[model samples]
Target chain A: MSYTTDPARIERNWRAITIELDSPRPGRLERMLQRLGLPTDVSRLVVATPALRRSWFVALGLSMLIGLLATDAAKPRDDLFVLLLIAPLVPTLGVAMAYGSNADPAHEVGLATPMSGLRLVLTRAAAVLGFSAAFLALISLLAPSAPAMAFGWLIPSFGLCSATVAAMTFMAPRRAATVAGTLWVLGVLIARGAGDDPLAAFTVVGQVLMAVVAVVGLVVAVQRRDRFDLLAVR
Target chain B: MTNSEIDAVGQADQEDRALVARIARRDRSALEQLYRRHAHWMTPRLESRCGDPDLVDMAIQDTFVSVWKSAKKYRGDGAVGAWLWGIAIRRLIDQMRKKRPTSVDLQAVGGLEHAMAFEDTLIDNGTHGSLGVALRQLDPDLRAVLIATAIDGLTTKEAARLLGVPQGTVKTRLMRARQHLQETLA
Candidate 1:
């Protein structure tokens, strides 16, 4: 009848719901994650991974530069070795910052959702690993000098990422990542020093050990999964 | 307008701008104040553009929501009312885009004609100056085209379709109306 279409209706509705056209949707990576079947909330959590952000990409780009330059500076045989070592290490930082109040701005809102905290963190960790493996695979494939399969780092990355998540159950995200990453770098260096070849850490025995670490870390993370659900004071 | 009336209007505009600034900082109260004040007048204008009240409600909701999200984008070069209308019209177009109009409907035709008449009455109510006098003096056909494009923020094609005339005819009528208004005001 009248020209005015009840404003109160919208007022009540908007107060009840947000993040439609009203709030900012997560940026492009989140949209990609959504298309891949992660729910909207979970995709948002995945994108908030600090290591997956633009600044981190700049760091990745620098690492790629190092990969490119390492080939030119070192022996012809050492091109893929640098990338193999770097690829598995990338997800370590991402998985570390994937959860925790200090890292995710929407951590509270995400935890409050029906999704369990373990599911949220694990999903984000998997996404981080997938993205890191993909980008690193791209680098290794595109390297001017490399062997047939540059994916040798994939298993090692899983081990270290799993170790980081398992460690997250014990302490802060950054601290967990630091401990796992340090151990990984140290283990690889020690393996290289003790063994004849420098790529000894990527050998069959090393691969088997890393896979075992992955399984054990995941089991431990699951056992302590409830820790992710709690709001730890910073 | 008298000195006091002009001062009151200026203060209201300032208040709206302040609310926009607060909304940029995500103040819910300021957003509510803005929606209440501007949408109070904006709804009737929107209702005149579209026949469906539900569509009107959707558009208003979209406009305010967009304002909240994009408040920081407000340049403040003009009145908040002007900035708001820019968003409102686009949101209305987007909402209308979602639901395609039926190809042939007598109700749609009548609503378009009725809306034109309503616009004429709206112009009549606001005929407070020389511009209004010039607007009132224009032919009804020319006035409808002018209002559709100039006030309702529709494109030439949209105005043509709304008035059921050719796009060239809408353009010619708009130019003629603008030229006439300019001559009258000058």
Candidate 2:
């Protein structure tokens, strides 16, 4: 038989009978409730405590505790010490790395309204770091003795994280960024320990160095402009 | 019927009806029961879309999880199976996004192949013994459009997006697909 592209035929075929699943088949309710940590009976409350939120809380609490301990240990030079110690709390970079890796190729292209990958990364990083810094600033204010001036580190720290994530994203193998970021932080901590003066713990030079590192990151990110595959490599 | 036999049938129906009600209420267990009953069929179906058994299973699992989460929103509009298929389609798309084709050509061919494969399987399972042979004989484009829009219940727009075609092309292809199917079945 000959085939034709008639509109009526298309409509007829397009609307097919919906299939029945014979669903909620048998014992599925118990299994799913068990999986979701919900109650089996419909009468009971099913509060879905997302596991991701729980993990985020754990990460936040741990970082705060680390911040408080670092402040207490270096009381007079609290600002410098806390910035150095909690430098790795620059989680926005990690988030950017994860976000870049997870983005689909179609999205990597096609969404052209003038936003570059670097711009997207920097914007998101700024938002996350800004909120984090604000939270830290509040904590410092409440404690009274804690140095709130360390909040200045937020700007460079954000830039550094964005740059590092952007550069690492361009390099082949996405996980390499995670590895490089981890090693870089570890190396910085080690270098600080090797230095002699106790007050040297809060040196402005170290913060400036990180600030420079962050700026360099942005420059590297800008250089990779049209390399969507590298920038969005999974 | 014997007393024991009557009780067994009544119990099974009671369980089925209860599950359907729970599904209507967005009960996760009811969804799980649905999964257990249909997963065997869904596994092969998704494997055709994704080309990996493991990926298909993961997609299917995620599909059920989504179904469970969205159960409270169930409006009892159509049969529960249609709703489940809708969820499954979304899950498959999500998985495809995770590890997608590296090139436009690969993506297009992959899309065409997935649709054609699904149609072949459905026809084989359609209870009409010769339907699979007829489906296999159709052109890949025709096969893909028919399976995606008709058997799968995706809108013409959705079918076009998945097939990497314009909506108008999808409509035309679908008409061609129906004429072929009707002629073959008749």
Candidate 3:
């Protein structure tokens, strides 16, 4: 074979010709990442969540403050108990908003992604839970509440959020949230009216029940996780 | 290959490996750099085989996306370019599987003219002879295996994986392709 017809030369020429075309436009990669709502910063590897917006957190924080002020104005004597019962509702709502179909605009794309829907839910839920916990802890410290009341809302918050997520598997997220919130409020009111301790829901027995509820909710949520993906397409 | 050619290929391999490492660390810039460096050539090469520019573009996008997600899994055993090709080819196959036969434009498919023109230039310059003609005369399957092994420099196992065929089949096809090309050239 002649030098020009050598297979190596031919391969080299072919590779050169193929690459002779223009490069893709500048920022195309950036644009694609943005379209996928991926973070440009390499270190920020967590998936983006629409529900964890600044406004949502602000609203949650504001609601907690309003709940505190209301309890202080209505019954200044036992404010800490009222605050614990109510404060967790805010973050419970956050968890509800973070994972459900109603809140995530990118739900369809997220479902199609290799990252399982359950994983996305769990990651975002954990973040929301952590943020809410910190926010409530700060509020408890600021309030004139006893030290024991500082973490009183923690158990009920987990229970409500878990139940909401579990209910979401079988029904729409908004409805699930509404039902869970209503039941929590009614339970608190009933306990108060029955001459029981206003903070009975946060009692040891109550905590154990809520803990059971949380565990059951989580199991149901896992078993029905695929429903989240299917619901997104719908 | 000439010493200079060997050096150039070696340099590219090193750069690609570095880029893969950065990508594994979730560096978006590295992903973009890898895309800009390869997409130009990859587009045309993939387009030549599939004939659909849209499908080629999809394959390119998916190739990078896969790289972004799985760069950590890269063992650095082979050329990064080959790994990219492996991903691109598999993505193209996936696109082909999803596309209905009637939807594909026959005219856009598998035009080796660009390659032929390059070979013609080489032949005219006395660098090669009728090797291009012999290559064009082979069956498309045989031609693909030959180009993958001989030109792309993939191992028989790699080529088989890329082509979705058994390694024994790739070896047999390669041997047959070589015998045919030698007879035709002679």
Candidate 4:
């Protein structure tokens, strides 16, 4: 009937009541991932094609076609600049379309999986960026500009795509794409208006600035990536 | 309450925080380590509440999966064990809501008897006698909030969300529960 406030005694009783049940068997989580059709191995998860489907590839091809057409239409002096501006949209939009609750149909399932939200977003972003960069590089050979000008869009594309993915962490995918796309277009227009050189935005200074922004944006994205897995706001 | 006890608690907290950080970085081994560390205690506690082994297992699985996804949101302000308990209890509640009436046969499973036995064991122990009796005397509604906020270490808001009640309601019940315990134990 008497009460005791002895901290050690209380701790002992608490520990007594907390019976340690059996730990789950190894590969139990892996089986769950297999049921969900996700990669069982965390290392293989990055290269898994679940995030990028046929629709994304179609979108990529269409975007590349549009870029090539735009480049062919523009004058020879503006060809490389036009390609630089047009090429990044493929990856920026691809990044948006490949992830996010609004973009990926399997988003809820992905969120519920063992893969961290940051890892999911980063993996998809990397795939989209890598695919688009390589595709653009191959297509740039057909552009009538110098080889340096041909690869001019690479840094800016990476920066813009990274920025878009970071933005998607806080907002819906399409909205993030719009905001990133608008900023990119406006930057190109302002640079064109300011100078006679069409490739001013892809200059050494511009490329360096873009690279810095890419790194910062990636850091920010990784920091806030948990927002992606949040239940949709009612 | 001893210095060594405090140090032990602090070390556990640091380890829990580090585990969560690793989980946020997609370290599966860290997740497994955390699961092994806490799942043993969490499983039995959740099973004691829900009284269904299947439901307890599902809740535990879902809790760790959620931890993997949202470990970045853990601010490290409180005990990590409490945070894990909060998630586990809420996941149990969610499963109960989804599978109520038909799936969880409380009477068939002797749920009330189990809970009573749990209470009696705590009250019989001299260390928990007063607190246990006070808790057993409160209405189930009030007791649930008290157990969630006080025993499980969930925030009032988190407790309210888990109980599907307003934050104000949880606070009021908590205050009333405390007053009743004070009066009875006095």
Candidate 5:
């Protein structure tokens, strides 16, 4: 017939969400990673792989030369430069293909695991970046002149290419991403025809523009978080 | 600061950071180090929730798989412990949900509607120390949501995601659960 407002009574009656200050088990995460076929050594080898990393740097060098030729300051080969600028996109395209090939089971299995969506994105990106960086470094070494000669243009070119790739990736469907990427690369060729210095054109101003594209892409991806199926090839 | 205490703190910080970095790189050793660091706490917590040793073990296994795949995404934004908790909670929910028929809509709680009536009776009469007893009386669904959101301190949005419910549903269920708990205690 009586009511009690006692704080201790209320606390005692209310279930505390029991939390244990311990971990799951020894060797569990390692075994899980191993099951996913992503062992440390393999990851390291993937990062250190020459084929995966250098393609981007090679593309960067070639693009810069094409840019220089577009400026028509020295009449270096025009057709050759076009091919060079086009080369880097191949690896990313290959990535799309590889991702598409394993689209089903990988996504299902990955989703079944405890990994968050953000972690998945970061790991995939890091693997790609490591390979690309190594390749760039290698090209710089084999042709000392290339790194030294293109140092000024390298940053802008890389920034633009990366920004474009990142931006285009957010486009719905792989077809669109592919189309956008192709258009952007072709846009460089058009800029060449405008008789402007490609290197000069892709300066800080170009970087800022590319950065804007990248930021927009990031926002779009974040906003569409729920729709990003691991099974979707794009 | 005391020299010995400071050194211990420094060592712990280094070890934690190293473990996280290695996990990001998909290093099994790093993953093992992380598991050793957290398993003692996580296992018992999961075991308490499921009350089934085998289910708890499976949940733990699933949690680590998630961690390995997503390690690169850590970003060091939150405490590693908290991140681990987040993963474990989600994995546990997934396991629970999977037990239902494939035809069952994950968003719908229709199958467990009967459990709510039983859960309502779990209200205790303001006995402060009897909280665990009251919790044990709760339906599994209500118990899980309360433990995850109220006790674990996960945001409602996160709880909704883990439970595979819409945000509105999580709020409704959480409010109802709290009211039951308050009345039971009072």
Candidate 6:
């Protein structure tokens, strides 16, 4: 037990300690993304989406409060009305906060790679949409019309989210999302008021219109996707 | 420092500084040299604070890993051993934190209480010389506070944070520690 053992006698059993040499084990979401065939770096970037950010929790908590309160206090049909209205806003909020120099913390580093901008936006938007859809579907089950009603918001949510990403190529995410989200709410309200049915926006005719919006918005997003590669695409 | 720089001990410190610099560039061999040099001494020091060999083992692993990652942060002016010990102690504290969801009480035998036990080990190893014997006669609480300030070179605020006591409490205990040590040594 001599403290001053010669260097020749010192046991360098460091092979036992190289476990930390590898990068930190990927988180659950990041691992899942990797399994889905995303590269390690891209998967990591995707998992850092708003769902894990502190502000994302604020957005989610607001949506949860709306879903739970609307279920308890509002009438059954009116509950669906409130649920439909709030569901689309979650992904819209997430997509708004997903990319752009203003929304992203890595904007300076991101500017170094000119081509990754749209790929970053699309991958991050997909993660946001998946998370928002999963969360909203669970909340919708609490509605009086449990199963069939659960799928209703998916199309509208997809439409609004895509439209926000489209708008984001030209403006900042927050402003783009605000404009997209506001338009969806106003469009739904106008439809509800114009018809005999309070849930006019949830009808099949309205669903087809949303499908059109999804197609057109994604087309515009792809065509002008290059705009996202520029500086301050706000 | 210039006058002391000629000493044999200072030359060893200078060698350790070069090893740390090499480690910053991800040199595996330099890290091994550092581990061989310090791990033999640091293990018993850590085990004296945390008896669990597994916790000590993990803490040692974490310490060298940190030294590898944070080598660039080394100021070069301080002894590399001191820098490694700082990371080791904090890492031990962190490992202890994982085993207990509640805050770690430093005074507990498995936690900072073991830190107090090191004073005994210091005497057993005769590393602290005559000061260790004199300090043994002082109250454990005063001795613990004194060790945090004197040996660890922590400021009042930092000692309070490390010991999980209020700043005012650390201040009071430090004053009492000085008074008690003077009475004991006198």
Which candidate leads in DockQ?
A: 6
Better of 2 and 5 by TM-score: 2
TM-score of chain B of 5: 0.58
Ranking by lDDT: 1, 6, 4, 3, 2, 5
Where model 2 places Cα greater than 4 Å from the true spot, the runs are: A1-129, A132-234, B1-17, B23-29, B101-137, B160-172, B175-186
DockQ of 1: 0.11
User: What is the C-alpha local distance difference test score of each model?
Assistant: 0.77, 0.55, 0.71, 0.74, 0.53, 0.76
Candidate 3: list runs displaced more than 4 Å: A1-47, A73-77, A232-234, B1-186
Docking class of 3: incorrect
lDDT of 3 at A151: 78
Worst-scoring 10-residue span by lDDT in model 5 chain B: B111-120
What does the lDDT come to for candidate 6? 0.76
DockQ of 2: 0.02
The residue-by-residue lDDT of candidate 2 on A130-209, one tens digit each, is 44566556555544344545454454455456555655545632454455456556655676678764334235776676
Candidate 1 TM-score versus the reference: 0.51
Q: How do the predictions measure up, each by TM-score?
A: 0.51, 0.38, 0.45, 0.44, 0.35, 0.51
lDDT of 1 by residue, B68-170 (tens): 8889999999888988987876677677667743344437655444443555665567645667778889998888788778886789987776566889999
Estimate candidate 1's alpha-carbon lDDT, on a 0 to 1 scale. 0.77
Interface RMSD list for the candidates: 4.5, 13.8, 11.3, 11.4, 14.8, 4.5
DockQ of all candidate complexes: 0.11, 0.02, 0.03, 0.02, 0.02, 0.15
Q: Give lDDT: candidate 2, residue A43.
A: 10
Candidate 6's docking class is: incorrect
- Each model's number of backbone clashes? 0, 13, 6, 0, 21, 0
Q: How well is each residue in A55-129 modelled by candidate 5, as lDDT tens digits?
A: 544666676444444544343333234333543453444333222223223555656566554344435544554
Here, model 5's chain A TM-score works out at 0.53
Identify the runs in model 6 with alpha carbons over 4 angstroms from their true place.
A1-22, A35-37, A70-74, B1-186
